[model samples]
Target chain A: MTRTTYRWAALFLALPLAVYIAFVVFPLLSSFYYSLTDWNGFDVNYNFVGLANFEKMFSDRLFSNAIGNTLIWTVAAIIVPTGGGLALALVLHERGIFANIYKSMFYLPIALALAVIGQIWLWIYQPNWGLINATLRNIGLENLAQAWLAKPQFALLAVILAWSWQQTALSMVIFLAGLTAIPQELIEAAHIDGANYFQRVRRVIVPLLAPASVVVIALAVINSLKSFDVLYVMTRGGPFHSSDNLAMFMYNESFQKYNMGYGSAIAVVLFLITLAVIAVYFRQSAQVERLYD
Target chain B: MTKTIAHNDRRAATASLASDRAQSSRVPMIIFYVLLTIIVLMYSAPSIGVLLASLKSTAEIAEVGVWAIPRSFELTNYVEAWNGGNAGIYIRNSFFVTIPATIISISLGVLAGYTLSKLKFRGSNALFIFFVAGLFFPPQIALIPLFRLFNDLGLYDTLWSLILIHIAFGIPICTLILKNFFAAVPTAIREAAIIDGANEWQILTRLMLPLSLPALAVLTTLQFTWIWNDFLWPVILIRSDEMRTVMVGLASLKGQYSVAYGVQSAMAVYASIPTLLVFVFFQRYFIRGLTFGSVKG
Candidate 1:
């Protein structure tokens, strides 16, 4: 408010601004520049290839596969986590036996790193004597159980399931918080108006949970788009890159194959998609801000 | 704001409607229980199996199915993981990185958040957006540039690389949390303090900081967990076994000890324990932080 305070403001803001610009803002802009060159991470004397990297992605089969897998993950991200979280939040919204413990049990995965989650599910999907096969044999459906992560057809889906385990927990917690904000009187009012349970939930609860859904769905979309760690730990985008999303694809291209330029192109594409989704998130969340106050 | 949400949820959970038809409630209640049972099993079964398998030899796990009870408890699995598997060093490196990073980031974030919240200086909105925009950008976009930059600084393999990177990247959420929080405190107190000749720094350190401990707790728990569990940057940046975070070490262990299932499981448990402690003790703060940061509650 005063001249001296304005000086303090500058002092306080200076450090964070410098660090943020150095680490994040500068590098992010540089990624676009680097994407246009043929830098293989070692040579200081690479040519500026001017959109060649982006053009190469047009015909790359593995790039196509990565996009396909990303589509699957993004679609699954929209449906599975949203559905599971909403269901759990609704169920947990009502009191039950050991409700607190159940809530913790589900939320526990969210705390663990995706790497750990990948390991746990790796054991669960191990071909021989693993949990899936063991249970399948016990139930006399041994044919149904196989190496879930090894099969190219199943590799991406298996990894998606493991990631969904953690993400679903996140969604559930957000929805539970959303559920708290709903007025019970609205639900009760509908209940007394001859509306069935499903009708009341459909008309009152779900609609009112709009703010939470925006957040949960936005998170799911972003998390799925950033499908690197879990896939890295689980499959390494393996069984011949069947599980490769843009991140894994980029890593494999840049780090493993030493194609940093192409990887940067992929990164640019991934960044653009994420930027669009986040822009939408900002708009929708603006509405949620209005709804709150 | 967070208090009302928690309070309202408690009431919602405990105060079920009495006017509901018994028949209408019963079917879905049964369905809910069934789904809950399935979900509980889905969440717990793999973990329980991993725990069981971790207590036995790989040979023994193969002899009996992984879901089978261990014939003998091999507590040595943890030792093997800790020493033979190098989890001990990984854990040390993680703590060395996570603790300093968390403390430094929170302090810097508070400074930025306080100024951005109350100072009303020119270009403050742009500065705030500068940090907030970081939240939207994917880490991949910065990978090549960052890798080269770190090498240039000669901090490539050292822990400082991660500590600085985390604090810089963590600015966005940290500022958002504290800014939203400090903004909520009555401006009259700030005005009063100003009239008393108290400076901005004094008001923040004495008045705002003490009043905003809850927000700090939320930021602390969330930031600590996130930095501790981070994998992408660590894997790319750290080289020596001595410098790898526990998550990167776990990934390496999986490659080196793929046949040693028991050891792998033990290391997985070791990797998850710290975050589990955060979850166990700060469950309330953890959930609240998640909502407040993302949903801006």
Candidate 2:
């Protein structure tokens, strides 16, 4: 390819590049710099504490709670969406109007904002007249019904279920796309070789859909770890910080409690974790592209 | 190369229904229907529950629960949400934020993407990396400083701040997707245009943009949903209720109408409609955009 010469390229990229660098790049780097300082949210004068902000985390219960909850979130992200998506994808793998309709039905949840999903789920989990409680009562399990979000024990799980509903739809769509890419000949051959449907799925379909599964799992981890919307709407990491993931905890600390430095530290920790995941995501996605391409 | 197969897949989907039905056994077909029926009901239940609740009286909702069939089909709940509930203002605010943000970001991304993909320029790779790096980490890392920056720039608590932020951050995915799409166009076609006395601006606008309408549609639909559905940025950046986006408005409705389940569901339905409408009408483009990076990934 020939170089398109000096001024034209510069002219073309100038505006977008300027805005992007000013907003996204500058703030991201500044966050790392600020993570070392003891700057309260409104303070102009602040001291640099190096790793001291990071060091205080060992004794911080809320930090531990956020981390543990984030871990639970990450683990759930890996399992639920991936498994459910793969299952749905397999069930709806056939080509037809029926498949398309069901596919869209599953995909519908992903189209809604997490805030809306949170509201819907919040109603479902409401104690007195909520769907879960009402259904539980109807089935003769009145004792099982309780305030899902008000109690610390069930809040995170409730939020995760709400989140997973959307995520599963995403995973299903990805898996369906992956299933589409797999050559029909292979599955046909497995059937011709006397393999049953389940056997064909186990030996042919699942293994062949590996690339899609990688994307699904990676996205689950990424979206879950980075999640703030649903939690913010539903619990705000609340009813005693039980539902707080890193992002929510960081928000409460930085925005509400005014622990900007400590919050920035948490943001850094989150960045580091996400960086590792993104790195893996890029590698796996690239490898998947190569394998599929 | 992949596009050909994708095209064939679409064709196959529309034409292969009879063959697909023939290949499967009666038992498996029954299982598929049963499974699909159960899953469809399960999947649609939440929204249906909310929809039903939105049509019922608050007293009826309290008496019958969200799951129970409603006796009252009240439009009063919707009327309340639209007028008294501030959903009307929030919907207007959302449209203001989403439409401009989506259009401007995609336009700028088109410019930057064309340069990055089609031209050999110094620092192009670095520029590409600069934008894409925005996608690697959570936005929380940038929030505190952006919070300060927006305040300093006096863009805080307004639609402008949210719009500007969406555009700026949107560059990453926009460039990533559009550049890859543009890169697939035969370089010879661009060279031919250049040889025919066309300038860069003319070629970009006349040749590239027109050719890439499908790509633009995919990008537009996705960005619209993302910008419209955005909650976190608006929640933190805007303080005033008048400036609130639909999401923040919906959240506030929860706090204000804690016992008014019908009102809350109505607001929830309002918040969901724009994105849901996009999905309904542009299902192909919506799915294409959602699966774009994943399949590419």
Q: Flag regions of model 2 displaced more than 4 Å.
A: A1-4, A286-293, B1-24
Candidate 2: fraction of native contacts reproduced: 0.77
lDDT of 2 at B133: 77
Docking class of 1: medium
Model 2: CAPRI class: medium
Tell me the tens digit of each residue's lDDT in model 1 across A29-122.
Answer: 8889989999898787889999999999899999999988998999999999999999888878867566767898988888989998898888
DockQ of 2: 0.63
TM-score of each: 0.93, 0.94
The deviation in Å at residue B221 for candidate 1 is: 1.0
| Chain A TM-scores of all predicted models | 0.96, 0.95
Candidate DockQ scores, in order:
0.63, 0.63
Error (Å) of candidate 2 at residue A88 is: 0.6
